[model samples]
Target chain A: MNDVTGMPQTAVVIGGGSDIALATLRLLAKRRLRAVVLLGRSAEALNEAAEQLRGAGVEEVTTEIFDVNDFSHASEVAEETVARLGTVDLVLVAAGFLGDASLEVIDPESVAHMIATNFTGPAAAMTAFSQRLLRQGFGRIVVLSSVAGVRVRRSNFVYGSAKAGLDGFAQGLDDALVKTGLSVMIVRPGFVHSKMTLGLKAAPMSTTPEAVAGAIVKGLESGASVVWAPSSLMWVFGILVHLPRRLWRLVPG
Target chain B: MIPGDTDAFVGWGNNNATRAVHRRPRNTKEIAALLEGSSMCIARGLGRAYGDAAQCAGGTVIDCTGLSEILAFDGSSGVVRVEAGCSLDQLSRYSVSRGWFVPVTPGTAFVTIGGAVAADVHGKNHHREGSIAGYIEELCLVTPDGPRIVGPDRDPELFWATCGGMGLTGVITEVALRLMPIATSYLSVDTDRARDLDACMEMLASGDERYRYSVAWIDAGTRGRALGRAVITRGDHARVEALAGTQRSIPLTYNPVQRLSVPFTPPVSMVNALTLPVFNSLWYHRAPKHRTDEIQTMSAFFYPLDMLRDWNRLYGPRGFTQYQMVVPFGQEHVVRYTIERLQEASCPSTLGVLKRFGAGDPAPLSFPMPGWTLALDIPLGSPSLAVALDDCDRHVAGAGGRVYLAKDGRMRPELMREMYPRIDQFLETCHRTDPDGLFVSDLSRRIGLTPTTPTQRKGMKP
Candidate 1:
């Protein structure tokens, strides 16, 4: 049994250990996805997470130590992971960094790190997987973007700007695969309280990781190309994107 | 805390909310691990026990819904082995197409197999078919020690104890159930209106034997003689030959679609003094005074509430409690007195269901007995409601009657003892199977099933 809707039974979670990724994996598991591969940095952490997903009833969860920072061999890793998991039905890109927003003026390296982690690395990895999905003639790729990317603000410009690049990349990639039997879902969430955002003060309309996972699942089931975490944020960002620069700068971090 | 993983759980009543660690474990191993990890733990299925029967405060709640699976089904023998998390809805959807149906189903098919076994739920057909426990052939229980397959003849005490033990004996991982073969999905129903409490009870008692399923919708709107006036509906599965035309083409159609929904909790309850009387009267007068052989869809006859999704939200933010009690055969007057009491107290009930129960199960905590069972869905916002229910409890206890634990949110521990005389036996079985006292829930602690420590439990009304 592959989900209540009888969708594909296999999936691969590229960025594992993050709260939203785990939450997304759980949703897929609930649909009785036959197999899932958690590709991440730490073996022990991935092993524990694999046990957790297995306990939650996923038939097979294979963990591999693959870092997103190792962007040179992104396609090689994707192929290996998909081969190990049997078939890659869906690929969820949730690996990103929300670097120090206050230090962008003092540090150029920190800003570049943010861009590499949030934009360049994931775009490259998803590109490799997208080619595989098209070759196979049917698959889904869900890229976790952010509302911060919708309209970058001075409060967190370094992180927000990086997400902006990733957001544009995801949308363009989605359009590129329109008729290739492969689909790309760009998920733009408002502030999500996951492990990455642990100590940060909550923002308005902040949603939970589970809520994001639920949205992603709904997106996958409905074949929606673009999905907003709280959905209402779609309209909220719609106005924010067109805000006058003077007013946008006045908004708080 | 993982926001979605850990949540404050409330029963179907949505009252007495408690903060508990909730984990939806997907397999039997996960269930076992959870039990082993948490000293104070309980298994929850669908969270449909109306109250805290499936919840534990400041403890781990292993949500068994993840383990839902229809392992195997034998068409010839009508035997099925399913994970405890399998909902009656899922089972019915699958089995009905194969010319089989769950032997017993509650008012709603949303309940799970484990929950059905744990509560030993009885349907309208209780007068004929007993509780869900009777149809169980065997069960796989995951205890702190490990999983064990217990059956009636193999481990009768553990099996019986686990049946109505409210998930206290252990977490029921899987169940091998005996399904009932049906010729068609439609029911040949008969509807009748009774003038008063006496007429309702008398009609149910006399005519119930002729039908496989029987239940009445009683009106608590009118006081005095008309207080318990009701519309009774009884039915049996329509045989294949009973189908007229298009129905014959698909004798086993198990499609239940939700056409409407109460999207969010309303600021005020939809059921009030102004609405209750009008709705009840409309419902009462709508029934044919005496209609028979009316072919009704199985979903319409068994689960009408399911068609309107989240109808519970209509009770408003405060939610409501479904107080279901069963009194012995000769003490049927208690039902009338309770109805009159509610009316006098000015406590309006949205809906009241009355059914005849025949014989008790071997499980000590099982609710049914050979007598009258009346269930009232009362909004919790009414201050007088709780007091009136207490009075009803005392009246029921005085007559050796008991309340269904599954539908209870707030019945006193002392009253529980009075209602279930063999509670000690159930506790003894719990101790024997789980000597460490690993399985416990808010319902168990609130009702003194486990040693009550005020610190372990919170949100109990004095």
Candidate 2:
């Protein structure tokens, strides 16, 4: 009944309550992924997300309290989830922040918080999970990287900078997993329409969590190194990333 | 815990949009979990049902599209096990490439297998084959109690009940279907022009069995002596040797390119009273008076509408209603009367199709029987459209015919009971399987099916 890769039967979703994370989980479940461990900040949101996953036909869903800002606990979270789910075949990390861009200029603590929430803690969790996957000798990891991180825009530089660091971390991790029976796929989505961006004016080529989920699943199925939601954004950002400093500053967030 | 997005959903016909909580279940466990938790919910696949059969107002609507996957395919036997959410279009293209085809398919290939099973849909080949239910080897359904595998020989009542059950019996998760083997992806067709209703009926009655598939396109706008003028077409799969030229090299390649599309819904419908006669006249004359062994792609023969994606938007924002009904062979006058009534009512229906169904399946609520089935796609801008359709309903019921539940939106409960003589039996079976009335849809409620009452709810849930 399983597809070519035998359809991943176990998975772990970091930042599980986030729209893109939950969407990716649903896509995985469709591929017959049986067991999942959801790690998220809000207990209420995690419970609701687990219920939703159950409705979407995931056989077993376990949620644990997690905060991406809690850097010291990141590795523990990964270890515990892996121990609980057992032999996780897929790990999807969609933990990040889109905090006020101006906060970096006003306070150092705010800048640190943004970096910890978006980069440090998530990177720690991925590092822990990556080691476990290598020991198991077969697994896939998908991390949600934003187009904003492709080339940090001044309007949201603080948030973009953290994603920039995480994006680079994912790329390095992907290279390190070469031929190790493990793989990493970094998803770059531009202006996603989600609860986090509800009130914000939508940017051109804005995609949905479902769209990003589709890209991630397609990447996993094809064993692609990276995926871009609304794929055109890959080229758009490719050219935009190389723009001269003066011209790039004029570009909106 | 994962609450679904509550929104208004409309059928293919953009009419009767009802608010419901839409949950797309990725697996059977999720579907079962939703069924267990939701007070009321109905399983929907692709939302291709022309009316509200897939919608549950103020309740949960489980979107089964996420469950789409071809589990297994035996090319030798032409048997395929697929998730119910797999569309006929998907299966046809996949199987046809392997020298196999779905046993029965509706005009639009966009319909999901779950919808096809729930509706008991028939195709142009009904005279030779039967409805989709006949081809279904087994069905794995998530009932109120749990999962159950039902087949014709085992649990025949539940099997028949689930067929054309309109998602009332349960959420169909997996279906094992027996596919028809074909030599090529093209159809060798014979076309003939019928001058009137009698000529059309005569052609279908006498010549249908000669070919594997047959259907007629009646010009509903024609009146008086020309009433029911039609272009009758009969076809069979073109053998590899039949293709004389370049097509012989790759006989089984499926036609997948959809070259045309309607990007957006126009402010007003393109199909209206003013456009009917001109379009009908042009269409009727376009076909040759008589053509034999004309080769056409399977898409051209089975799914011409699919060529232009989102063609339904042509009916405009109000959308269109498909009134498909079947009248027994003895009551052929009802078909004629219904066509005349549409003409009098000034309801310009496009693509008025007439096909003869050969035999009825064991499914009690299945739509097809040994009869003449006429389907009409009438745009829904006219104020008198509902009344005219209801009037036709009575005429059909009087003739021992019934309106298709899949195509119904405004049918009365009493009339439905009258049309379906075995409603009591269908209800009794539903009670035994889904006594709690958890599997409810807008169509079921509108027609007084699975009425939530103290007696019905007895020994059901806390």
TM-score of each: 0.64, 0.64
Estimate, for each residue in A1-253, the C-alpha lDDT of model 1 and write its tens digit.
1111213457787777778988888866654365788888878868888998898888778888877778888889877875665346678898887767785353877778878888898898898887654433346788989988888878888878888999999989878865444568899999999778889989999999999988887665444678899999988888888889998888986
Give all candidates' CA lDDT scores.
Answer: 0.81, 0.82
The parts of candidate 2 lying over 4 Å away from their true place are A1-253, B1-4, B452-462
Residue-level lDDT tens digits of model 2 in B199-316:
9999889999899999999998888898899999999999898997789999898857789999999988999989988998898899889999999998899888889998889988
Query: In model 2 chain A, which range of ten residues has the least summed lDDT?
Result: A1-10
Worst 10 residues of 1 chain B by lDDT: B453-462
Clashing pairs in 2: A48-B1, A51-B1, A51-B2, A52-B2, A55-B30, A57-B30
**Interface RMSD list for the candidates:** 21.4, 22.0
